[model samples]
Target: MSTLEQTPIGAPGGAAPAGVIHDIGYQRYTGPRLSRRHVVGALYGHSLRTAFGLGRSAKAKIFPWFIVGVVVVVAAALVAIRAQIGQVVLGYAQFADTMSWLVIFFVAVVAPELVSRDLGSGVLPLYFSRPLRIADYPLAKFAALATAVFLLLGAPQVVMFLGGAFTTDAGWSGVWNEFTDLLPGLGYALLWAVVFGGIGLVVAAITGKRAFAAGGIVAVFLMTTPIVGVLSVLPSTTANQLAGLAAPSSLVQGTGIWLFRDALVTNQEGGMGIGDFGPVYALVTVGLIAGCTAVLLARYRKAARQ
Candidate 1:
């Protein structure tokens, strides 16, 4: 062997050599780090955009905008109906009730887009690895979804309000009255957003696959609604009153009727039959939101550790 080939590759006698660091000019960031609120706000805004498919591909936007279009068109039609017939066929609260199916569809489509994808992409742990607390991730998402749903329901109501306000025969006073009526409708919409948004996000978070998440969300909403109908028809008075508790839609509507019976229920006979259990409905609404939020936070906490 040659003299060079006879030598060990490392130090003398085949010992390994120590590694040396190669430094190009490198600098550490000395700038101030963003606070938790900024992170929460970012998550909230990004999630809100995702809820409506903003900044996403065209295909991603089609469904959200489609639902938006449908609701807006319906609002326009209601306005036209008012102008031509001089009758309010769909009141503000009723507008939300009329769009319940669309709301369900929107939540089904959107909740999955918000969280399921994060779970599927395996980025939730990465999210939790940062300054974001476990609750922050889900709560921020819930708020975004709730806000999106509020806007979804509110926009049409605004259209309805504008139509009513402009054509009022009583001048500004009538406009003020229309505005007052519309406030409850907006509040009711927020209630819907809270209940629906909370429940939908919980379902979506359970499954990583967006397709499955969406299906489960729809199934949850659709399945429970029939229970209300079945329960309301039963002979027992207690059962009839509590029937609205079965489905989220009825739960929210029951609460609405409780809070604003004069607006939502025209004739006494056509009411939701919640009876004296209206307070129960309101309580359940609060409980359902709290429960979902708790479950969501728990789920993310476990997921973060994993």
Candidate 2:
């Protein structure tokens, strides 16, 4: 009658075969794709909340200002006691160099916490069960740490640059010049952040324990720099980016200094600045970043299944 009279399957009675419930159950179990956008949004919100909470903490609020006050008091005392204090203050213009410390420490220590905690605590599995995907986790974590580092480390350089421009003999035009000059330096810093952040992520994913991951990252990074720094001095072979073992900051800073030196040498051998470093450093920095990202992703694929 109605298609209910199906074709026979080994019988004259022309009956339709029953569907398997196990197949239906299996179909129901298929998971959803992890959404990158969702992960990013969630991580962004989380980071903001954490930052805000830290800002509200009484100890945190007092600690920073206390350090600033101590530095200012010391500077004032130095100025009153010694004429060289003025020179020292002027040399403070090179303060941006100190940002490398925070960049290195934050990348090696803080990034791993953001990455490994969720996975180690089983939160990642719950997140994966939702609309969020596994791939999104690392991307979101990377974005969060990069942004946090920028805000924490880069923002100070920006403020100092502006402060120096306005408060010092450097006028509006000088300020603009300095700002333009900083573009390359900031670009290198950003690339280093990404490279190190990726290394932290890979270490976290593989290690699973936050403390071990963080400590191992810091130790390895610290150990590598000195070794590379010594090796860089060897005759007949200047340390290229490869021997650095993915050390982006050292490579960028070193290369940037070299570019500045080249610029100065070409122009009456003036004092070398960051501008001496050429585009080659920038290119190599980008390559390191991309390479770290690729390794992180490949390692993540394995981590996900585990």
Candidate 3:
């Protein structure tokens, strides 16, 4: 046979050889691959959508209103105190101080809703069935809320610093001075947010009722702080500064500001150095935050495995 005639039948152009072709039926799937960016984007997009929807609705809008109200009240209070006392009020010194409260509020109130709403509406299961992973849920939620909290809490600090700088004796140089003065303050803000945010997430994960989570967060972070503060004064080692359940008191104490004064007037140096019990207090703060993270991860793993 000629070379052309001897070619196999199963070639692309034609089939000449008998029994050369075998049909193996398999459906080809040409869908796009899901990636981390896609997942993160979905999460971020959902968060923005959720926030927007809340704004459009009456009941949901309450949260934002509450935030605004808090800011307004705080601003007014600061002004009044400055006018009356010739110094800023306790707990109303800088934007960072006020923003700390906002972070605490967000954790206590908004966090439960983030997860509980989906769980209540039976949306969580559906999320798990898709390319969405359980781990991403907490991460996304934290990131979204953290970003908002930072903007809500941190941005004001920047503005306040700027305003205080140029409008007063604190120009750019003064701004830098205040910024340096507030480095510890910034760290305290982050420590507070992460610590409480993690607590809120863990509580939401553990409970079926969002109310329970919310209430628990309040009792643990808000009410417990004072209670622990009282206990810490009872002649115990943990009572001195470390006795409190959360980091706020220690942070405040470490910051050397008492009862929310603006002058940084405490006899203590605000523990700016790690050797100055700053490290010890920081380690405690980090430990609490780490615990919350562990709890969140463990809860997510359990849910995912189920």
Candidate 4:
């Protein structure tokens, strides 16, 4: 009665072969195909999660989450201090300036994991086989990294805002003043995210080896600052001020000061004061971000073409 049957083969003196190709009612996919936009969105979400060490092994998550935990604890402590002192010990505008190194470290560690891993593992071809375009890959990756960095930098500022608002004694007016101050702080944080995220991703994109990429990112951030610091002390004030532009961190801090129209506070670490360098720092910051992005996109385009 059955039209299908199994066949067995074996050597004359050996046991019969045992295997079956079953007709278990497998079917071809008949669902609507997802468009390239959907694919890019999915990739973006996935890469964003990866940046924060979400959906990964505990070992993989320790660095990013530990950095996050440290920031949260520091913010909580600052809030408590502010409440007790009845004065702002750490203003939101200075938060990024204070924590810039940790942010740099985070970008160094995570950016390589996102882009370098894909390249090093020889998986780009597989990614290319999907509905995703070449440009879409880097754009999505950059967006994800930038978003992760933004959250890392922005969350503490939010905490600071709440802390400042609640501790103010002048009721709603105090809260309003604090809110006004917070807006510029948040804007500065976003600039840090974009600039740092762009540089980190571009460095990572240059190499497939995660170790090398991470090292390159760190060296670029760490080495340039000291070099600029040395140069800033030169006898020539113009040379000293111009030297500030050499360091990415300084550029970011200078841009923040310029954009926020805020005075250079003692706690702020990088760059010459806004008075010293003015809008050149901001222009250079924009240039650095734009240049890195162009290089990243161009690298991906070449990879996609090949």
Ranking of predictions according to lDDT: 1, 4, 3, 2
lDDT of 2 by residue, 1-306 (tens): 123323445655645554322322223555775565756697766754443235356753453344334434543443343343322242221333344555565555565556676666755566665566666666777776666555554544454455445544457787686576556445544544566666666677677787788788777567777776665555624343334433554565545455443222332222222333356566776676677677666666665676
When 2 and 3 are scored with lDDT, the better candidate is 3
- In what order do the candidates fall by TM-score, top score first? 1, 4, 3, 2
Model 4 sits at a Cα RMSD from the real structure of 4.6
Q: Residues 113-144, candidate 4, lDDT per residue (tens digit)?
A: 99987776667777888677778889899999
Give TM-scores for every candidate, taking all chains together and pairing residue i with residue i: 0.90, 0.64, 0.69, 0.88
Candidate 1, which segments miss by more than 4 Å at Cα?
A: 1-26
Writing each residue's lDDT as its tens digit, candidate 1 over 89-155 gives: 8889878888988999999999999888777676777787667888899999999999999999999
Error of 1 at 104 (Å): 0.5
Residue 12's C-alpha lDDT in candidate 2?
52
Question: Candidate 2, after superposition: displacement of residue 216 in Å?
Answer: 0.8
Query: Which of candidates 1 and 4 reaches a greater lDDT?
Result: 1
Number of colliding residue pairs in model 1: 0
Question: Which regions in candidate 3 have their CA more than 4 angstroms from the true location?
Answer: 1-34, 48-56, 76-103, 181-184, 236-238, 245-276
Model 4, C-alpha of 100: deviation from truth (Å): 0.4
Q: Compared to the true structure, candidate 4 yields what TM-score?
A: 0.88
Best by lDDT: 1
Which prediction has the highest TM-score against the true structure?
1
**lDDT, candidate 2, at 193:** 57
